[model samples]
Target: MPEPAWRNEGTEPDYRFTLANERTFLAWIRTALALLAGGVLLHQFATELDPRIVVTVLSAGLGVVAAVLSVVSYTRWRANEIAIRQGRPLPFSWVLPALAAVCLLTSAVLVVLLLIA
Candidate 1:
């Protein structure tokens, strides 16, 4: 495939930085997959949880978060690559905190469901 125009704009970054950025991107992808799997499993196997609507909504929320994370991860990886090549400070993102909040909410909801069951 042809290289992106942005890749030609900046000096080539060190291979180590490039590889590390790739690894980070893969890690984010893995996390997103895991969340998606959790959603599917919850929907399929957690038949005992009451308030089926709430469970369904939570499962769908996880899938949505996974989808958003997958997109965000790629964008973050590209931005990081550009910054590294240009010798600029990495851009900050709210992705981590937002992900944490979602995780905490999911855990709390699960705990409540378990308690109620």
Candidate 2:
């Protein structure tokens, strides 16, 4: 079998560490999928919320975030793998803070919306 890029570039990392990195990547992908679903559901089925424009904006924001996260996941996975091979500190990713900010904004928007509704 042909070696993957990470496999080819570095000494083999412990299997457990590589598996953990894969899990983290999968988790990010799941989060991205959830955001995509939420955006689609809100846009298509959530007709009762007032200021429907707010809902639309929220939906679009989530979708954009999802797209961004999807791209981030692969880059992060590769960086972490390279770092592991190089025996360097794990590379930092900005996706976490961005994800947190989106979640907090969504929660605040929902809370204010519920209060008004």
> What tens digits encode model 1's per-residue C-alpha lDDT throughout 1-117?
998999997898889999999999999999999999999999999899998888999999999999999999999999999999999999998999999999999999999999999
CA lDDT of each prediction against the hidden true structure: 0.96, 0.90
Candidate 1 TM-score, true structure as reference: 0.97
Would you estimate the TM-scores of all the predictions?
Answer: 0.97, 0.88
Give the true-structure RMSD of model 1.
0.7
Which has the greatest lDDT? 1
| Candidate 1 ranges with C-alpha deviation above 4 Å | none
Tens-place lDDT per residue, model 2, 25-89, is: 99999999999999999889878888999999999999999999999998999899999987899
What residue runs in model 2 are displaced by over 4 Å at the alpha carbon? 1-6
- Model 2, CA-based lDDT: 0.90
